[model samples]
Target: MVPLRNQLLLGHAAEALPEVRDSELGDDTYVLDRLEQGRIAWLAGQDAGSKQAFAAADSRLAWEDEQAQYRLSRGLAQAGSLLTNDQTMAYRVPDYERTMLHHYLALNYLQRGDAEGALVEVRRANQVQEQALKTRADEVRAAKAQQEEGGDEQMRQQVSRGMPELDRLIGQVKNGFQNAYTFYFSGVLYEASGDLNDAWVDYQRGYQIAPDNLSLQVALLRLARLRGSPDELRETEKKLGRKAPPLVPSIAKNQGQLVVLFEDGLIPARREFFLPLPIATSGGDFRTFTVAVPYYDNRASDSGPLAVSVGNRHEQTSALVRLEALAAKDLQERLPGMLTRQALRLLSKEQLRRSAAKEGGDVGNILVGIFNTLSERADTRSWLTLPAQASSWQGSLPAGDIRLTLGAGSAMRELPLTIHAGQTTLVWVQRLGNRLTTRVMPL
Candidate 1:
């Protein structure tokens, strides 16, 4: 049997119930008192009491009017928070009504330096707006159409905003499917507005929704180009079942110097280098070997202030100089012999014991473990000095992207790095604890 209150709560559905027709508690005023008490409790910061009051009040309002009733209640609660005890009583006055009661409440809070409270009210108003706009089926459809049309109009307006290059870029983006194009253009707008993180999310979403679309592809391509690697493109290709672009052969050889030029931007999206490590030494052994170092370069925004890491293209070039170890050794000649032996024993037990007999092969599994450990430390915001070997020594390298971004402009470029003899000149081995746990691998 549906109670009269329940009937009112569910509007017409409950009203039709047999019990509702026979109930003496059908008086609307009694039910409205419960709702008023709830709103009053909420304004007084008694949330639990407010919730109970609200439930009772909700039993009297018709289901069709529930949303509107809630909106009104919300406005009154916000306004009540700003009112003095006397002003609060005035709010209970029957004749004093205002459409934007919540808006006024928010404004009062803001003026009183209660930004957080003001924001809460403002957000409630926005939610109410969304609710009102979405209640009707026809209105929902119309709103969606209007939203799409508005987006299109916004994109067109963006194109005509006087920047020819930006317009061209926008047009190129729009040549793709509608949803993908919209996301891509939105990303561009966010990027131009100095919101790179938001822009990146939009770009990623665009790519995710329509990987093969030209606009998404081109947008990703541009990001990859700016960030400095085709690795993302290649990885994304695998995910999307698309083929990666063919890897180009190296045309130049080592000239002894390896220059790894990275972007100065906040996210450092890509990295590029003209690493000129010599192919072979006088004894025919590779001298300054080169390996491509790949890492995810994320920026907070266009105005990034994070320090970007730039490591040696060849890992063997710099040995870890432990300050404690170095200081002890430097104090006396006798200490050097003991320290060297200790270091070798540690390295042999830790790294060499795990090193395989294979001369050169994939060491991806080991690298993964090492990286995971390092990442864990990083996650804890702890500083760590971990060792890595030359890339050439690792047999199986974990295939990933090496990102690079433009030094000054917007063009981010991505180049593929592999373990092929000509392309990889350097390798780094990971030393876990005191021993080499993995064989050397190219960056």
Candidate 2:
């Protein structure tokens, strides 16, 4: 439903605003719509408009984040969903998506040349990440309590364990929510503002999450050596092991660094399918009934690296994080809870069907069953506007007005950039469908 419309409206962001504002806006997806609207506006180079939309989305989410009652209300809301499907429940942003919200908001601020505003959003994102880790246990306990009320834990666990591809993909990351891309970006921001200490901390954390990233490895080494942290330097070098070769030298006093941020394609959307789950009937016999569930393509792909050429000098962007992988991991964490909710919903529907048969006869029961089947929709909702992959190219460039050439596949684009001495210049690039957008920020 939303996924289809999102794909259709992918490149034509500005022209599609009226469609969401006029027809498709729903009470259930207010926050999601706002997020989509913000993304599109940002893509269209409307930073102010994007800021407004993200703010509206955050207003509701901020309330939920501040109030413990709102977290408790999630279970209460599920009670109302028993008669219907999971879509009836209001959309709750996954931990990763919520963090991205602040991350994107920071970008919006940056687009407007508001560093303080961007810093605030970054701080908020960091707070949310910390909060998610702390509250994960409470959330799991709440879900467990709700599951005990209805649904079989054995069946839930079976379903969770059965998705081999999903399990492997989720295992790629430490968890479903934390990503190195955000960490790297945060570090870059802090470093741009001359906060080397905070930048060092963020880079260290990013390296912890993704040890093999060359950019992170170089950042750690460069900082440790520059700031006289020989112990930390040796430790990182040891961690790099045999992989460390052809070492990249630190930027000299006269040269500036070009930090390229490239976002490729769109995040993989969820597909819907009906699954027949086994449950015991009133007579103690097991029966299988169909329930719609959401899934994604778990296969991995290597599209090679983005090539960055400046005159004779050449560099390739390294993968920081894959959004689709993060999405899959997030979905895996959410599956158990989703299955539990589906079980409760199906059990409730069974009682309703029996009541219909008792009161109105076989015809009424058949009609109710048909209605249930028709209304049984999987909640295939997500922040569909996110990029599929995030990558970066970090290297030192001689200070001057330089022509920067960047390419991924068939087409290549060139831009003129001005790099100052002893500073960092960020080149943000996005390839959405046939259109290409680039932003230059000198720090």
Candidate 3:
């Protein structure tokens, strides 16, 4: 599995496609399988395959969301996994991942030249955020109830002790599910389509999430002046302080917008972290076992903002989303529920061990012990092909053919783009190692 992720990061989409081919549809990672193929095809410029794979992923998620009757079946699956481990249970996509799926779907639609489809998908993505906000209280109450019912206070305390690193990793993010990257993308689309009100709303939303982001601040300011009343414009100016965006082209002069979306590197994968749990047997003696959980390591990021230059003018892209921070925050929020489930599993496995020892003596006990140890691996599945950080750069440029120099690290590429008057041109760049995959869409 790690090799497959590594392969995708190294720009080996052809080799990685076979790992999640159509045959793995029945596996625990069906959604992840589709994501892998969809992402591979997308980065390789295979739009049709990308859309097909992503559409299948959307269908599977929609099925899960629409199935009220499936709750009982899912509950039964949880019970079954108690005797084994989470690896045996069905994979439930988290809110952030689901939102990301829709985000990519929107991008796919845009690349296919369907603004309506893209708008619909981004709205769907925002809906996921709204739903998560709506359910957060209920989720908290459920977690509290589970902790109280299971008498998992000690386990919860232990879990909290190991979370400082994760806390630090996620400190920059406001929340896990609601990311500014999607909001900015949505805002760009709305503005491109001449829907000024929607664009203003979305850009304001993104600015609220990432107040320090130059691109977001400028976007918000631009819209405020264009459509907002004087009072509203003043308020936006106050919020943004005195910092002004550099090299902005005046749309008043018939300049078009050059928007660059730079997705850099790969999202760091979750790894297994464990806690030793001592389970008391029937004879009042106890055996200790390692109970595993997923965690994101605090890896240092060396990737810098992309350098964009046209003529003597230059701009460094602003990071719109620290996606890895969102990933960390998401896992931190879900850790308690996972801990509760593992506590139940610890009890279930201990009971099975007792039964095996009584039924078949030492041999049965040893066999069950081996099985337990082997099945103790944590669930580390995630959308590994997602960028570690999503960044952007937007500026006003004279409407004409523009030759731009884009550089990230030692890698550099020259792109010749046609910028239309009073329209927006989007350049989507995926930086994988030294490989730079780009798509240009002018709206």
Model 3 clash tally? 0
The C-alpha stretches of model 3 lying farther than 4 A from their native spots are 21-26, 151-156, 159-164, 243-253, 279-283
Q: Supply the TM-score for candidate 2.
A: 0.90
Candidate 1 achieves a global lDDT of 0.30
- Local accuracy of candidate 3 as per-residue lDDT tens digits, 253-370: 6788899999888888888887776655557786787778898887635588899998889998888887888888888777767778877777777778879989999999999889
lDDT of 2 by residue, 329-441 (tens): 87766776787887777778888888998998999889888877887888888888788778887887788999999888764789988888888888888876544578887
Candidate 1 residue 425 C-alpha distance from true site, Å = 42
Which pairs of residues have clashing backbones in candidate 3? none
* Candidate with best lDDT: 3
Better of 1 and 2 by lDDT: 2
Model 2 alpha-carbon drift over 4 Å, by segment: 1-11, 21-26, 68-73, 141-149, 153-165, 168-171, 241-251, 277-279, 284-288
TM-score per model over all chains:
0.18, 0.90, 0.94
The C-alpha RMSD of each candidate to the native structure, in angstroms, is 34.7, 3.3, 2.4
Per-residue CA lDDT of model 1 for 1-443, tens digit only, reads 22432332232321222332122233323443443344333333344654554444334433425567655754564333221111121112110001122332443343344545544544443344334334433433554454444322322232223111222212222211123323443454444334556556666865664554444454454454444467866665656565533433332222111112111211111121112233332234542222121112221222211111222222111111121121111122121222222222222322321343233235743553344233211001000111101111111122333321111122222333343332221211122212221111121
